[model samples]
Target: MKQKVIVQLVDTLDLGGTERMSVNLANTFQEQGWESHLVVSRQSGGLQNYLNPEVQVHFLEKKSFKDLKAFWRLSKLTRKIKPDYIHAHSTSIYWAVLLKMLVGSFKLIWHDHFGLSDQLEENKRSEMVILSKWIDRFIVVNHKLLDYWQKLLPYRKNSIVYLSNFPYLKLNESIQKLPQFTFLNLANYRPQKDQLTLIESCKILDNEGFDFRVLLVGQQVDSNWETQIKQKISEYSLQEKVRVNGPSEDVTSLLAEVHVGVLSSESEGLPVSLLEYGLAKLPVICTDVGNCAEVLKSGELGQLVKVKDPKLLAEAMKHSINNYEEEVGKAQQLNQYVLEEYGALKFFESYQKLVGAVK
Candidate 1:
């Protein structure tokens, strides 16, 4: 049997959920005895370090939306690689569509990591519809997205699939003890991430004399947003209670020190952070957004609160900490469920079957 060749395409290797998934898929493909290559249409960032050394990495260094040089370079590379399939993550589908037009033989699969769900604008939907004809398959992260796209392109229902994002960490249990009751929010500084709401919740915890700290970890995607978060921390006198740490590659080590994991995003497409939290076996407290409720089994496995409500978030956080033993036991059960349902082995197996059926 011939080994399948796959090229995973993405805008960059930034510390975002989509970027991490692209890297994870590429690595998994290589590990599963496939010819795996990763191409970054734009420049690379910190997440590049996490990529498997066996997978080839290419950077086009795209300077603008219409950089003909970058386009030519990607086209040339695609021609040389001659992959059996080009798996495009997020907006990289635009470039993959162009490459398909130029090359004409390899399959093009678009992995939709669109965070807005049903809130997508008219122009974006129109653009996606126009491009849907060229795509051979559409891989969605959740059923909601699958349903939305299925209804949008009724004729293309057979081509769309719902593939959950799997946990990609290799954890080593640490014997070291954590200093304080710590909660981690593992998302980049963005408006949609709603870290400000997390800060407000921290203020509430502090006012009630809770001895805990919340750590915000990820790249500062927006400098203005980071400044606003800092201002809120200062205004609320939460300098000690809240800490904003930039992106770190050592997530497993960080996970070992935290007591709880939290995601306060306003929107999501089945957040990878939630999976990481499960993998780390930390009790999760997340806002009711995206597929979070589904991932938490409607709060049976974790705690879910209303978005933008600091009081509710604080109350949930307090409840989780107060019932740490019981909550952690439930989190441990969730960890096993995640490993069974979204493990790397299962993800790779599904992709193999999907790609086999593409032709």
Candidate 2:
């Protein structure tokens, strides 16, 4: 029998990229003849829909973040599972390290999905530093993060691996037939996501008499960020041009319908949204953040505008629309690039190497 693989996440219900990717990876493991288990601190999010019957999910009712009782519960659970590998995503790695120390058996792999803006905060940096020594491999989404992890945790010299969070999006036929002039941005409302910049840029386009509709798709992660975005839209009277749609599982379908995909994030870590855009053959406009420009091949696949610069962003958006056919051809070429580089088979191959190195 193949060894069991365990994925540990802080919360199971959240529909964030990290959680969704965790579910994807777990499902992949199952198809490869490995038993998959998802262990989470809480049961409270949108993850239920993504869970496979083959993958068992355990939600431990922890006392609190600082409570020793929670630690004990986690440790006990880990001991019972005796997983071949314990793959941790985000801040959960910190606790996974402690649990590993207590159980002292399963191999540890740390997958990073958080963006550059997340690393700027002192508290998060300190936490990464504290947890650096305990993990076996540091899986980053891009070279920038790999460098950051190396500097922060230099002892793990050969432990870094680049694993982009690109998923296999099965496009729905219905959405593929939607009308053009629809642009999509899939990100939870957050300052770092910079939806305000996108809206402002859209306002510029509207003034220029561009024929387009903007679809902002994501849930309100931060209430203030959501409120600020709505206010900006109201201020610009962009209600006619822009529509804010809440988070939807049909991202590929949405991408299929749109002519252009835009992300004006102040920071990111190889956003899956861009990858989804590429797969759907939609021309993309993204700010130069994380690995977006790199994936876009510095405007070969899509245009990269400066973050928060509405004028540049507006110009790029218009240029993309003006050169629609040519840009989409480039997008298709980029789609092939992603299929070769970030596909599930490639990701699994990289996973094997990391697992071998640690094992």
How high is the CA lDDT of each candidate model?
A: 0.89, 0.79
Model 1 local distance difference test score: 0.89
On TM-score, the candidate that comes out on top is 1
60-84: candidate 2 lDDT, tens digit per residue = 7665677687677778777777887
Instruction: Give candidate 2's error at residue 98 in angstroms.
Output: 1.9
Candidate 1 lDDT, tens digit per residue, 190-253?
8889999999899989998999988999988899999999999999999998999998888888
RMSD of each: 1.3, 2.2
> Which residue pairs show backbone clashes in model 2?
13-45, 13-46
